[model samples]
Target: MSLFAKRIVLGVSGGIAAYKAPDLVRRLRDASAEVRVVLTQGAQAFITPLTFQAVSHQPVHTDLLDPEAEAGMGHLELARWADQIVIAPASADLLAKLAHGHANDLLTTLCLATEAPITLCPAMNHIMWQAPATEANIHTLETRGVRLLGPIEGPLAEGESGPGRLMEPLDIVAALNGAAGAVPSIAALSDKRVLITAGPTREPIDPVRFLANRSSGRMGFAIAEAAARAGAQVTLVTGPSQLTAPRGVTRVDVETAEQMHREVLARAAQADLFIAAAAVADYRVAAPADQKVKKTETAQHLELVPNPDILRDVAALSDGPFTVGFAAETQAIVDNARRKLTDKGLDLIAANAVGEQQGFDVSDNTLQVLWSDGQATLGPAPKTQIASELIELIGARLDATG
Candidate 1:
């Protein structure tokens, strides 16, 4: 039942991962999908059109204007022929072009002409993948209902390892099988306003130095995306992180804990739900040196002061939003989370154990969610999947309370 008889237009973009496109075509056909391959000029640098043509058993389309095919508008013909369009090894350049609606090439032009759903499997250097511009482009694509499969974490072509690898050919086929039947859920948060805080806030130590934590903000960003998909008007107050704001979500970037606190409280009144997910610094320098502190032979002592309790403050508001808080613990996870839940007067709290191996700067997560009456445990799965499940739970609990 996986992509059987589906007409898939396979777009190959420029990247080292282009070498895997032929295998991807084979896998798609193995799942009984009819695949037509398209190649960009840059893609031709890594793999030839003939190679794809041989594997797909179909002519590989490359040019925007063809004397033989343009007489009948070949791009339009291919555009109208597809049931779905998939770009494997979607380069950062391709993404930016698509995001900005550039149709100078055959593939981009076909994408503009097609009415079928589009899916992208991004592959790039780890640093490039995490770039702010790339993040914004991805966010734009997601909002336009373009699905993304992966830029999963793994070894890159340059011998560095991070989240820029293309999903394996077999894995892509398996995922497409699942994606083929997937439908958007009901708009559970329709007309609702959601405020979420994410990432680790910094506390300035000197002009060039700062105290920060390992929070990458992936979990919070995923939750924001899930909430947006559920039709909520989401405002994300995020600390400094490489991840961008999700599509259809408004992003407010801050650096210090105080800035995050200010932004969250400013918008908390208008929100229907609030998720305090930021790993904010518990303390900051009482009076940090105005200039860079010079290294000396003697020890340096910094006077630290407690930071504002953001979750508790928001919860204490009169007729405020239904507040949810997150607790990342090293030991006594549940006990600490439960304490925070009650102490902060939160409607619900999600807690997880964090150490060198789990949580913090990672892509996957496991959560123990607790409300006053009941509790649930969510998977040690990809953060995106966890976010989806967590959102479903949030929507159900919100309904129950009302």
Candidate 2:
């Protein structure tokens, strides 16, 4: 079946977006998805379950321990029933619950139990949305591989204009469908926000010397170009590279992994998709010497510390983004790549071998793309061509997921 026809559970938490739940149900139905509604206790206060029942033609599930809930195993039943779990108007409370892995209620408990892809569409006041606690929660969720949609910038109910608006039902559907590979529009990612990290980070050892790589940033740049051409709002967070940014793509350049980490986390929750292709330095000089060391010194024992794992951190976010990671392995290509995919909590990972012949500082590339349950391979072609095919695969995989 088309991914859109797959079963979905619409999780309505307490928020103004609760009022929009009926429209959301209708929209999912229109997409041919079999959507079941799960309302939080707070959500019931804002909108009646009957409203959802009227549109979905299925009973709404609300209580965690209700006897009427699927032979009294409602939570478990719903958990297994979902192909995707969409928490819309995901309030601060809901975000917090998922971030800390607190299954205190049916909605949160279902999130913990389901193997389905989870997408959170946050809605709240601008200040609360931007609060440090909320941002931290978002970062945690994203790192865990949950997909986060928009709290788009616009007028708010609290007489403010900023970044805490629940996404429109159509836009949310488009985002979900786009990721599922069902993007019917040729510009499948049109209006979708995409964040990409590329190039090699420089880890400094001294004023004059630093650790670096031979990455030319071509693959990441190509992906950004293809995404922009597909009508996505693309943000490129690149390490120091000689290449220029693609037209219509916003570029943010940094020299170190730490900087890249900050840049990515700051904007992660706001994105619909995140592709991390940067060959970030795994370690940096723990204490980079302020001044260059003089020549003729005995063998130096420079201490090194691990750099922030950018992809892992991004994947850690609770409602982060549709994250894609790239694995550059020199041996055991599939096994190593699959390990990274699971280890990093990525929605998808592109694996390729790197050496003098195939990848790294090369003009062409190839990839073995892996999701949690499937895989695909792209060619040993030019980086540009490889990027196009990879982007297509990404769209398809995303379309297939939640």
Candidate 3:
């Protein structure tokens, strides 16, 4: 139910995502939950205990051996104190330690000693996440009744992208609270057929290379999941992504923008809703080499041609499904979103500013949602949480219109 008075022992392990742990503490406190933090030795390199202390308004713990703490029985006391133990940025190393019964550190020791429910929000590189060792450890933890939130797909701290980004602070809080009965599922899209697109469409340059964007398809997949959970029969026409299709949703995999266009239009007529979340290439090489092109000393230019405007095309359909569009803008986010909302004849549009630090490849994003006569700002939170809110709004609007 409410996080009110709930005691949450947040374990921050060594990982780039550990920086987000302080914000998580604030979110917990905002929800009226009492939070105590435990940082692994590796975690301290990324963030200091003082940061957690300031946000949590409590002392930070990092050692299994503390002479000042309950005469060196501190780990057991913390174990007894918690109603829940949440490990955000649960590094691959920590997961293994927990799985194999390692208790060398205070966090691991507390986990072994505690009877409280444990939830882990795993954060690491996508490759590591897909590793057999990690998979086996996850399976073990799940069988032992441990809960996992996400190492959701998106850009990572390293200059690469995939699933491994930590769940955002508010998102983790929402999930924790939701599981505790703070929120209930709504069958808002019950019996509705929903069509969605996700990820980045790749336009061929040659057999060996292509043009693509930074979209990881996380937002689209999340919407597919949330919509499915809300009782919609969803078909996700996704571009290249490592994410598996959400449970209970149908999946259609495609690559280039042309392919995505074909797939969505072919199924659009049967849908009750269409969400165009893919970052489809606006243009493609006019002529692609049949074989890989040879590098030359002189610079070369590519002849580009415009790709089909899938959103505009869908929105133009007579009596089409309630159409929703996404606008990824580099500037003037609200104005651009509003213009697209009107110009494209979209029922609704969600826009966000995307750049090096925001939107495109990252796990967390903010949406400027616009319609004919109304607007709302959602997030600056996790894409999954934003998807849930947007789906709820879509359902309400759909009901109002009908």
Candidate 4:
């Protein structure tokens, strides 16, 4: 779960992407969010209110003029009920309506009446999205403080494609989770420099061969995003990965374990917090061929040498930052994590089980956080939720120690 449970009202508008509503509701619930669905009349053309009701385990609101609810001003009631109003698949028509403050429908009426922040995930044809009126309407909504998620440029439902496709349900969830209840002007980690290492470091055996792990860097990148959200001056020292850097983060890209170590050591003194989340290869080929080695008739012997202990070196610094380490073990998680806490002189260690289908290349992860005095288990959920909880925990610990 996130640090706080959110009461989210998900409004689905008329678009081909309305088919994704069920999965969006499921994801919100999976993150421990309370979800209620609001469907527009045109949305019923694609998905039924009954289908949404089944997945949400609640009645879906459709009619703007329901006799029973209208008796108590239903739109106003729902507007007050939401902590945030997220309209996914927000069509061009709906955007225009909301921008002009039209209350012809339930969703637009709720947008007008709600004090909660409005987030729109615009989904429409590229031509409609690029029109002068639509662009002006979006700017109008933005000026009124409405947050726009994405119409990420990619393939579209229409044969001709440009921009204006709705983001994936998971990406929407991540953006919502990142923005929910976020204070507009709090200096939570302000001016505090944070350096985080993420992803899998490659150790080259030859020109065409290298050693690496399955680390996707989702958790580490989530941490960087969360830290930045709290107003930290964040520097993400990352290994080679396809992931983009989080907004407002400085990414220092590196490849080999030696490169990561050099960067971390160089940046440690200036950081207030140092998180070693990269799955650096522990060993590398001692001697390598200048070129790609060809298959030999005889059995080949390869020498291996240990890589530098990046975390241990950082912890041993005279003026080191609050050092954190990750222990990915197959068994005896707590014991191994506790041992590493002392062995590496880490201020904190987050332990997880690796191998099989868990923890390495997945979007969701769990963590057992171990410190000298106590421990806390943080998962069985998405990495985004876990990351928020972890940041909150770190903030609390820093306060306690201070």
Candidate 5:
């Protein structure tokens, strides 16, 4: 398969494998890719920019503040220039920065600015790679749809054989080829209409303010993307979030719980499957102020009224789609999910813990899925991976029952 004229941004971070970056650039070039090199500050200590420039025959981008770069918009320029990004020797620090959305350097900044798919070939010591924090960061990156090539099991720079070695240059090239659609595809949900809800609904408190939850909508968005990849006709009804729509899916934006309810109910009749992934607000202001509520000396007691339950409403439909619901709970996860699955007339329910670190705004998640006759556990992975697994399960159940 030809990768002719593909624009590739290869990032070299600090590690002993930094020396191998030039070889990686050469391999990409041999595949007919136009490659640009971005050297992290630590990478400069191991492999000089001159070596990369000499090998790739292109200017190496390192500094985030270079003035000569496209009118001092160097980072933005590089971000927009790439079709794909491959970061080899992705250090622990770099991974942490990416996981937490830090953009202190050009590499991390470009990763954030670019719309391109990212592939990270992590190179770290075994202990560091296996550390809880590092694994968490890796999970976060994966959840955000950043593809990881291995820190495969092999000899490490410390002369100890274990996981953490970067994948070989040629192997990396093959992975890149697979990413570019040269590999055979999975069409599990072909021709199925999958309707999904996502993100946290915002309940207005006033004209200028609202109440919302901590949901990042990552899990829901991940499911939508996975369903699209599975060749399902997907419609995403999302609340306020900064996420982009997945390929081949339609997105309908809504805010308050009532708005999401209307959108989901309007489209639920046409769907073959319905996944209620949104963290819709349970309550809203009984009567929102027409103007911004003025701060008062006396404490104000805002009254809250229960919002319409979108999941229950959809599941109550006479011939509704096979419905799935999500229960993000702090305790009794399985019991609660099972109860919801029954009470809401859902075909399936997924339960997970939500706290400061485990769920909600965090990158990775774990799930316990419950259905009338079966169950599955997933995650402690990138939410995208979890979504992929969950979508497969959904497909299987549909196939079995259909």
Candidate 6:
């Protein structure tokens, strides 16, 4: 579980992106969240209440005037139920209603009556998003301390492209986590420095060919976000992964295992905690071809050499940071993780299975955390949730040591 278990009310407004509500519900549920779905009448035009009911495993609340539900003022009942209310695909009309404190519908009525913090994810055409009215409404909401996730620039459903696209569901989750104080700012991390390596390192066999894992750096990026939220000053030494640097962290991008090793070693001395999450290549070409090797009908062989063991090297440092390593295994899960924990001298090792539907290139993941003292299992959930739990555990251990 996350450090906090939240009761989230997801309000779906009318928009083409209503189709994604089910995914949002699934993501939240995977994080061990208690979620309730409420939809506007306009929302039914895009997605059915049945879709939300299936994912949230709860009755969808839509009608503003259901007699039974309104026995005690249904909008007020729901308003009090939420720890947070998130308006996704918060359309142009919805923003206008919220900005003006309109209560014509159940969604607006709840928004007006609720004391929970409101978050909005605006999705619309670029022109609609940029119109003077929409911009003014967004400004008003922000001024009133409402959290805004995104109107990220992207290709729109209208066959036109600009900065009116809704943020990805994962990013929305991150934003919510941020708002809930899950990720601390650089000021929070100021007392302790963090070092993290992410993405997959390449091992070249020839001028044009190399070996690498399928790691997309999502997990590491999520960890960085979690760490930042916890108030740690983070320096991310990453390999090539197409991920934006989390706000308020320093990022250093590297390409090969050797390059990453140098960067990690240099930063480890100043770090209070070090997470070795990069999927580094185990071996590299013994000798590289000067030119790109052409395909041939004949069989061929290439010599290989071992790459530097980054975690072990950091662990061996005279005054190294608290070290955490990752074990991506195929079988013998716990045993293999324990072996790695002992062999690498890591303070902690997080192990996960990798194959067809397991780890690597997935938004969700599970982990087995092993240490000299004990072990804990996390997830069968989103990577973000797993990351948050891992950080909390680490914080507890750090407190114990102190």
lDDT of each: 0.88, 0.84, 0.89, 0.85, 0.85, 0.83
Please say which candidate is ahead in TM-score: 3 or 6: 6
State the weakest 10-residue window (summed lDDT) of model 5.
178-187
Candidate 4, residue 44: CA error in Å? 5.6
How much is the lDDT of residue 16 in candidate 4?
A: 92
lDDT by residue for model 4 over 273-301, one digit each (tens)?
99888888899889867899898899978
Model 5 lDDT on a 0 to 1 scale: 0.85
Best-matching candidate per lDDT: 3
**Which pairs in model 3 have colliding backbones?**
1-180
Off by over 4 Å in 1: 1-10, 17-44, 48-85, 91-116, 121-144, 148-186
- Please give the lDDT score at residue 42 for candidate 3: 99
Q: Give the per-residue Cα lDDT of candidate 3 at 168.
A: 78
Per-residue accuracy of model 1 over 27-95 as CA lDDT, tens digit each: 899889999999999999999999998989999999998878889999999999998999998999999
Backbone collisions counted per model? 0, 23, 1, 0, 0, 8
**Candidate 6: residue pairs that collide:** 183-229, 184-228, 184-229, 184-230, 188-231, 189-231, 189-232, 189-233
The 10-residue segment of model 3 with minimum total lDDT is 178-187
Candidate 3 vs candidate 4: the TM-score winner is 4
Off by over 4 Å in 2: 1-188
Measured on C-alpha atoms, candidate 6 has an lDDT of 0.83
Candidate 1, clashing residue pairs?
none
Name the lDDT of candidate 2.
Answer: 0.84
RMSD of candidates 1 onward, in order: 6.0, 16.5, 6.2, 5.1, 15.0, 5.7
Instruction: List candidate 3 segments past 4 Å from native.
Output: 1-27, 35-148, 151-171, 177-183
**Candidate 2, residue 385: CA error in Å?**
0.9
Q: Model 5 reaches what TM-score against the true structure?
A: 0.60
**Candidate 5: residue 71 Cα off by (Å):** 42
